[model samples]
Target: METSDNATAAEETTPEPERTGIAAQDWATASAVPQYRAAVVDLLGALAYGELAAFERLADDAKLAPSLEDKAELAKMASAEFHHFERLRDRLAQIDAEPTAAMEPFAKALDDFHHQTAPSDWLEGLVKAYVGDSIASDFYREVANHLDSDTRSLVLSVLDDTGHGNFAVEKVRAAIEADPRVGGRLALWARRLMGEALSQAQRVVAERDALSTMLVGGVDGVAAGFDLAAVGEMFTRITKAHTKRMAALGLAA
Candidate 1:
């Protein structure tokens, strides 16, 4: 009888499975660490602002569309981008972070990036939508690898293609086929966008201590072994992805 009682007690006291990676833990488990919480807030804030900016930019870019069909497609993508922004904003508030205040720090940087990389025409707009936005998405997806499961899921969901990539690819490829000279111009534009996007990303990391620490030193068990070497490798991967995107668009990387 005593042995049976002991066995029951042992089973009742059994520990939960150990969480081996950020993906194994939910936001409630991972956000217990102050630094990790701060890092997540910063990450979400930046992403929220980026989505909002993309929404606005795509709407404006629609004005440059060569046809009403193209304009309507861009409008649809802009709505999707706005929906993404709302998700991030709601998540921030659910975590008790002020949505606008959290997003404020990143607003200027994202605004400047858009201002600097403003596309001149319909084809340039298509290329920027495909190439520039994909670069940013790739970077965020890399960062998402270190996020807690809940946050990671939200981030990945919002990053889903809003049919923009295929739409941009079809339009840009058709333009290039129609005029090979357009391919060279767009390729040069894409390269410029890559440089600016990387610079903006580095600037954001440098300015946000919590985010930079999360990337370099990591927090809690997330990105536990991440280092400078890993950062270099991440960028190399992003560049390789960019080259493939350019190739798909019938442009030189």
Candidate 2:
């Protein structure tokens, strides 16, 4: 099992043209086929912009914090997101794709999601941090299995929460403990977040042929692509994870 640092080192050792060309072509052909390359760029682009948006959203959320300590904590998470965005942007350039161009297709869909589900208060913001972010992370993790090694490692690295989710869980649980009534509202809010996320995801897949095909490409030994049964199971897995996390915070899924 190569660590992320080890994988990054491996990625760096390749010479320039080959690194950006044959190596990529060989990896894509052997794994996802050449056409999957577009999907890879789309994936990386979406992730990069998502992290940048998260940084901005978290910074905005920090301003609504009740105390300096809380503000500082959110600020730290925001900073981490910015760093992740930088990594994804660099990865885009390494692949000879324009970062802005790759990310452009996803901007409207993501922006719409954020706008429609904008957090109404501190609790809502915290819930979005956990529920919304985790949904995106889970979807990416599913896609990562079909990616080449370097991209897989980069995706995994960027998705790491660095205990930010735990912090949200702790704060949310404590609030629920203090006032049981808050849990009901948050639960509803969480459901809304999930709905909006799924809606946007469906929209993306419907509009983006490459990304949709990649998901259904059945790469990595998936014999049937993402067929109905497979997609159903995927949703089940995501729901299970969401439920488990919510339970950990003493909230209903």
Best by lDDT: 1
lDDT of 2 by residue, 63-145 (tens): 88989999999898899899999999998998789999999999999999999999889989988878888878777776665
Q: Assess the local accuracy of residue 219 in candidate 1 as a C-alpha lDDT between 0 and 100.
A: 78
TM-score of 2: 0.84
Q: Local distance difference test, per candidate?
A: 0.80, 0.75
After TM-score superposition, what is the CA distance of residue 12 in candidate 2 from its true location, in Å?
Answer: 29
What's the residue-level lDDT of 180 in candidate 2?
Answer: 99
Worst ten in a row by lDDT for model 1: 1-10
Overlapping backbone residue pairs in candidate 2 total: 0
Model 1 ranges off by over 4 Å:
1-19, 221-226
